[model samples]
Target: MASVRFNLRLVAQSHWRSVHRWQPKRWLWGRARCCMSSLVGRRVMLTRPASQAQGMAANLAALQAVPILLPVIEIAPLADTSELDNALFALAAYDWLILTSVNGVGAVWDRLAELKVPGLPPALKVAAIGPKTAHGLEQRGIQPDFVPSEYVAEAIYPGLGNVNGKQILLARADIARPALLRLIEQGGGRAVDIAAYRTLPAQADPTGLAELRRGVDVIAFTSPSTVHNFVRLCNGEQLRFPDLPGKPVFAVIGPITAQALADYGVKPDLVAVEYTAEGLVAALLNYFESQPLRNSL
Candidate 1:
């Protein structure tokens, strides 16, 4: 049975090689390695707002995936900024300014410039829900006092210290969830939730829609709003997802976005370990590399 044992050893070696063709360490390489990637030539559909898709698109492109920009949501400034203005005018009265997204930071700063507000109050603490949001604040020479390890709304409360008897200004999207507001209120803080920007359903780009109709390999959702807007746009346009051949893989940036997909009787094939564009791309690479092993088994 020595020959039989030798044959099994060879078979195992071959399987191992196939499974680990692409190593996670190689993903750190700055240059494109598309020639050796399973994601090479794969068409990835981006469903975030057009303004936000560029970075993610560039990441995918660097990895040699064809990024089809099918922005399902648009971020627009509120038509009536009266309340936003009122909040900004009295910024010194608030104890904390909570920003959840890059879009929120942009909206707030744009209004701040309009109001000729030089900067935030010296005593006013700032909190960001994620590193990306924190980076946005940093770009404007403002450093956040609190940034949660977990990038979700629920995670922000714990890092916010004692909010008891404090006034917190939450600048967020028009359709933002009430979880953060509820959390602050439960902790005895008065939270003013303002619509910093409007997340509206975008008219799908014709070129991108055409590319999608031809068939894409994967679709990525960054937020719940993207998922919701994607469904709304698809249904409103009479495009039946069930009819699409060889259903594309659904990928989400986080659990919340995945949950949004699940609400519509859909499940994500990949969820990013980190809720960021780079994390999503890394997850996709890891996923595609394991396909051979999955198929072999």
Candidate 2:
């Protein structure tokens, strides 16, 4: 009986060890750890009172229960339509069409539809920097042939493989980073760039800004302009949730936006592993999962 009991204990210990090896922590615990870790070495600059900070956890809980409401912040035209038009005309002659943003896809499609340009070249293939742009293409009755698993300029560029002597047309925002275009040129591809759209800061909506100030559990900034506009609208007003510096989660889609947050003295709670809306959403979900204690409390 004693020997059997000892063996049973050993088996139980081994089982637990194997379980830990396979799943380091349960889902809830994992989230809590992530949230805690992200905050450990960060600084908090609360413009609000201590009571408001503590109330943030409760506000977050309530916000999580509600549906995500997205507000349109801005819409504007590209700086140079002539350049865009010329680029689209070149599209039918190029070997590849590379879209870096959903805005790019929309701009090109809208322009082409307006011009009634007929038929893309048979040799031309489309590539999107990320899933959002790919989905934008799908909505226009087109499909992207390539989308990288990781949605960053660096990641997407390498996945293009060799493009030596290939003609590639890149459509993007007026303020787009030059990394992808530089990479294409370096890879021996003849790259033509066109500014598809421009983004302007949205008019300040006082009511909406007040609601945002009241308490936002998670603030998502999709672009640098959004970050700039959001900050401009809010100014230096004290937020309802003060603990946010330590806990309130801020998510950004790309490095440029992430840097913008830092420049504004707003620490991001989560940075998307990739540069796309899909990746942003995934990163948010992952962040929520990591803060089990905060979520459960």
lDDT of every predicted structure (CA atoms): 0.80, 0.59
Identify the candidate with maximal lDDT.
1
List, residue by residue over 131-213, the lDDT tens digit for candidate 2: 55766776775656666656665566765678899888877777677888898899899888777887665554455455454
lDDT of 1 by residue, 27-83 (tens): 534536534766777888999877788977887887777898999888888999999
Each prediction's RMSD over C-alphas, in Å, is 13.8, 14.5
TM-score of each candidate structure, all chains considered together: 0.86, 0.66
Worst 10 residues of 2 by lDDT: 40-49
Largest TM-score belongs to which candidate? 1
